[model samples]
Target: MKTIIIDDDATARLLIKKMCNAYSEIEIVSEFSNAVDAIKFLNKNDIEVIFLDIHMPLLSGFDFIKTLKKATKIILTSSDENYALEAFEYSKVVDYLVKPISKKRFEKSIHKLKSVIIKDSLVRDDSIFKEKQRNELYVSIERRLVRVPFSEINFVEAKGDYVKLKTDDESYIIHSTLKKIEAKLPSDNFLKIHRSFVINLSKIIDIKDNSVLLQKEIIPISKSRQIELITRLNIL
Candidate 1:
């Protein structure tokens, strides 16, 4: 992800940059000693993440985040641990990394960023999926909650600890286990295709080789579930 460092101390900025060198995914696009110049750069360019200092010379970190109308993820860096709760009120702030930040702690923060991206992706997918349905399930996106019809749901895919709900319009990720959501769904219409996915039987437009086609997307049907899917179709 693209990121920028905003801190008054050059030494602190250098240290933070050095720590970021450990990861290939994170790139420091620029660094600013004050929030004023940083704000100008941010206005013109889009940044996925920010390493913001809690205390600065003129404009504090809290005030800097407030200036931007659009939301972007932030990780607050500070010597003091007191403002952690206050920082959370700003939806953009994902974590509070206490200084001097350890490599392990920094790595942990990177992991968190990955999960956030996955969760956000899931939410986006879910929103699109819901938009095309007649009977839908709703979830939060940005600040608003939207609905998606159950019939339009194509399937759900599991990635690590998260689940991706795929529909006709898009797919969504929720930080939930598949088993938990499986219980909530109607088993009569949906069937587990693989260990990682659950497909809507009625939504299958075609079954080719080892995969099932829904609309334009092709989803794999596991060897174990192939017979069950065929049987569920009630072939004479």
Candidate 2:
């Protein structure tokens, strides 16, 4: 991944660069002493990741992030840990590291960056596929064929002979089987976590033990399906 360092402290920048060198995947493309210079460089260059210092001379890291038109993954480095919560408000901020960053913590941040990249790539690829295939499902409701966009679907629960399609806006109960609906949904976004439940993997909030949290719902994951779900995640 192409990376850049932005820190007012020269020693801090050097240390981060040296640490990043340990990872063969990261290539240091540029270094800036202030947010202003970094912003100038970023206007013309495309970088995958940035090692940003929250406290800077002219513009602060948070201010610099607000000025960006494109979303770039940022790992915040700071002497004070107080800004950690605020830094994460921006979705672009991947990880926050305190000054005197340890090797283990830096490695964990790299893992997070890779996971974000993988998830983003999958989302983009799925979008392209949706465009080509016209991702709309035709469901028999009443006597008419209702059109439902694949992206709106949250999960499908088998209710005897009918399947309940829960979405962000509303729910629909159609005369179908879980297996049939699962076949239509994209494998990348949807997974069969239980015999009667097929969840939209993208909608997941957290996974703990045998339960997966989706919105306000806690859905159980069968023992056999748990392994498959974990395999799908980009874990380091």
Candidate 3:
């Protein structure tokens, strides 16, 4: 994959570049000492993956991603491990690595490129499915079909004839059955939390006795689906 190195630390960037050089398929197009230069490069250049450092002067790795129009796979490199959970919030961030990265772990991170490909492919499929059913059952309220990232949706609530897609900021009521929408959703990121609810496992805030707190909504756990939800969720 075509790649770039964006880290404030010179040594860290060099190490990653060396590691990437070992692989025949990987290409190191550019390197930046700060996110601003990297952002500028990204604006014009085409890249598939980025090795970014979380802590940088002025512009952070997190902030740089926010400015991008096209999302590319990111692997965060840092001296500390505090930002691991926050890294997962971004769909583009595939992995987090601490400083002094070992060759073994570096290779593992490269292997994660396949996962990014899979997710991008699934989203393409979802787009095709939406276009096929666009005229079939769509709400007519000057509604815009927003691409709610798989990471943003908390859970879905099924009514009699429609399903409500609940996200972090808002909810949209689509004129469709749970089964149809469920088929379009990515199985790896989202789970059938309940018979009537499909939830994004990453957005789960807390898990109570018989319910899961997803964002601001609390979804019930059906007796039959509890085991399945447990398996899908990474509960600590």
Highest TM-score against the true fold, candidate: 2
Give candidate 1 regions above 4 Å deviation. Answer: 134-236
lDDT of 3 by residue, 56-129 (tens): 99899899878877768889999999999998898888999998899999889888876677778899999998
Candidate 3 stretches greater than 4 Å from native: 129-236
lDDT string for model 2 (35-100, tens) is 999889989999989999999989999999998777689999999999989999999999999999
TM-score ranking from best candidate downward:
2, 1, 3
Clashes of each: 13, 0, 0
lDDT leader: 2
Better of 2 and 3 by lDDT: 2
The alpha-carbon deviation from the true structure for residue 3 of candidate 1, after best TM-score superposition, in angstroms, is 0.5
Worst 10 residues of 3 by lDDT: 133-142
Q: What overall lDDT goes with each candidate model?
A: 0.87, 0.91, 0.83
TM-score of 1: 0.56
> After best superposition, candidate 2 residue 38: deviation in angstroms?
0.9
